[model samples]
Target: MKRCFTALIALTGAALPSASGQGHSALVQLQAHHSQADLEHMEEHAHYRYVGELLFYSSSFLVEEGGVERAATEQEVLGIDLHAHDGLRMVDQRIAVHDPLIDKHIILLSRNEFGALVLERLSPLDRDAFLANKRATMEQPSSKTQ
Candidate 1:
């Protein structure tokens, strides 16, 4: 009986992190790797034209409509909200290039899991700006006339 009790206690200790839902370090590491890859891709494509900080949070809410007697409809919605949360930081760097291809840039930073941080690429211009830029570029006269 003593040996069985001791073994149970040992097993419980080994499983405590999972049971308590605190094992997020692995997810954090994966996010870090993703951030690195994004940075590298941005550099290779000459897209380093802007640098900024960002903070984001994601949450899931159970939305219930109507009363329980009338067949309450409940659904879980995942929402991502950006905020200027405290203690959030980003390290932005641009690659060494004489002439960057892009003129404007935006960076998105967010957290994964509890404390993991990630960086994503974003375009600074709105839809109209993007369309105008595309049109202007396309309308430019080339050296060889059509």
Candidate 2:
């Protein structure tokens, strides 16, 4: 099995509203493709694409949809809504949390015929512990680094 991924950086990406109600970050588009090895295979490869966005508030970021704040599950990342096609198929998706001191990152993972980690999304973990750490950092005077 062979696979390829293409990321389309939006030239005019939409801005996400921060916790302060101001737009700060841009949403990026991502695409994943998979094809079979056998030349006899008649079916075309499968392609998936979606726009990724994250909302920052206080000291953390969360996946936002229609102004609603929530964690991005596996389904939120790779679930295709388009019409069904013939060829390889997406097998499964998973979400994992990685905690490193104050910075906790959440990773979205997907599996398909191409490979186990066909797609992934790295995002900040939204939790009280992380929020507190971020808030403290934000409140600190900038002179410390100077």
Top-TM-score candidate index: 2
Can you write out model 1's per-residue Cα lDDT over 37-84, one digit (the tens) per residue?
Answer: 554443333221111111121111111223111110111001111222
lDDT of each model, Cα atoms only? 0.25, 0.26
Candidate 1: where are CA atoms >4 Å away? 1-33, 49-146
Clashes of 1: 0
User: Lowest lDDT 10-mer window, candidate 2?
Assistant: 50-59
Q: Which stretches of candidate 2 lie over 4 Å from their true place?
A: 1-12, 18-91, 109-146
**What's the lDDT for residue 91 in model 1?**
33
Q: Model 2, clash count? A: 0
